[model samples]
Target: MRAPGDLRADARRNRELIIQTARTVFAEQGPSATMDEIARHAQVGAGTLYRHFPDRDALFHAVLTDALERMIALAETTRKQEGLAWDALSRFVEGCAGLRLDLLISVAGSQATQVATTPEIGEGRARLLKILDQIVSAAHDEGTLRHDVGAGDVMGAVSLLIRGLPTLPTDLSAELKNRALRLVLAGMRTDPAPIPPPVPAMTANDLIRRLSTTGPAKPAT
Candidate 1:
């Protein structure tokens, strides 16, 4: 029999391949893409796939958690640069917008049920939000963002844009997305008059918990 270390390494390699294959397959075929498909793509057996992920929800939660962790790392790196916080915020927004769009689209099209709010996913999301809060707070202190706007508002704007992206023509989509983001950013600049009170910002846990409750994506008109 192989040594324990060798077995562990082999298991780790298989898990990595499974995740990589799942990401590509999900992107191409949406969430309805089957475990069999993923296993075939990864060149692994169904038994191995089952060993790694018990169900579609488990797989999706893993994918989302991985994505969130990467975003958190990106946000932290951007935050460290001593520059206009808006610039850092804008970079993070631009980088993550496509990722968010892909994930939402996959979820919408997938056969998988709602993702479980696993603790690891929750913690990753919370860390991302914390970094975002830092960026937003810096912008507020610098008087770049309006007094009333908060980190949640910025993130919500990104989500709105992502949700609308699938509706635009392929030729016009990229350009329009940038233009729309610019318009929203301009709107967030300091204003002379006090704006009406906005809704309270959602906590990181609130955001993660609500993902499972999202309704089916309406057909684009």
Candidate 2:
């Protein structure tokens, strides 16, 4: 496989610049940020940007793939920690709540989000789910997580929280985000009688479908 170090000096620089510039532009302009704008911000020509990322969906795929890889690493680290299983799970979940929240919010809130679900995105999501399942199984074994709720339930609940994030006031978003997350965890506790008929986790396909449908379209100029 071609490694980062294998890239020629200019090619590597251009690739890195495009991703860096796109991150900032996408955050500020949402998923509607254009390739020309990203290319300009990166001090590269439109041709250069296209050479690195052929299209908008491809750019999003690269950005989200990296974000998902980071999250997977975080989850692996948290899972290895020695503590109450719930605590470990909570740490991973919290990290996930903030990890790429901005990027995903923009993608999910965009009108063209359906096209953003590239194969790379799907693979990243699947890997994440596998890691989550490992942690969830441990939590259940330790009597921390409710026996009835599976990893899918956790995934589904988090999805609900993420979908609502854009609607909240900017100032209160973080607070409400934390509150919503805590509530999702609280419901997974073994203390009270667990709710029956566990909520299914959102599959990679389901997540893409849901996100693609969020928010109204930007009005035509």
Which one is best on lDDT?
2
Local distance difference test scores for all models: 0.69, 0.71
TM-score of each: 0.69, 0.70
- Clashing pairs for predicted structure model 2, backbone only: 152-201
Model 2 lDDT per residue over 1-221, tens place: 23557989989888878887776677656777789988888999998888778777778877766667877898888878847667777787777776644565566544446545767678888998898898888888988888898878887776666555544344344555666676677778886334232235436786455446643334311
CA RMSD (A), model 1: 10.5
| Pairs of residues clashing in candidate 1 | 31-110, 32-110, 32-111
lDDT, residue 192, candidate 2:
35
At residue 35, give the lDDT of candidate 1: 90
**Count of backbone clashes for each model?**
3, 1
Which window of ten consecutive residues has the lowest lDDT sum in model 2? Answer: 192-201
Instruction: Give lDDT for model 2.
Output: 0.71
Residue 205 lDDT, candidate 1, scale 0-100:
75
Off by over 4 Å in 1: 1-14, 43-45, 104-116, 167-169, 191-221
Q: Point out where model 2 deviates above 4 Å.
A: 1-5, 9-14, 20-24, 41-47, 108-119, 192-221
RMSD for all candidates, in order, please. Answer: 10.5, 9.1
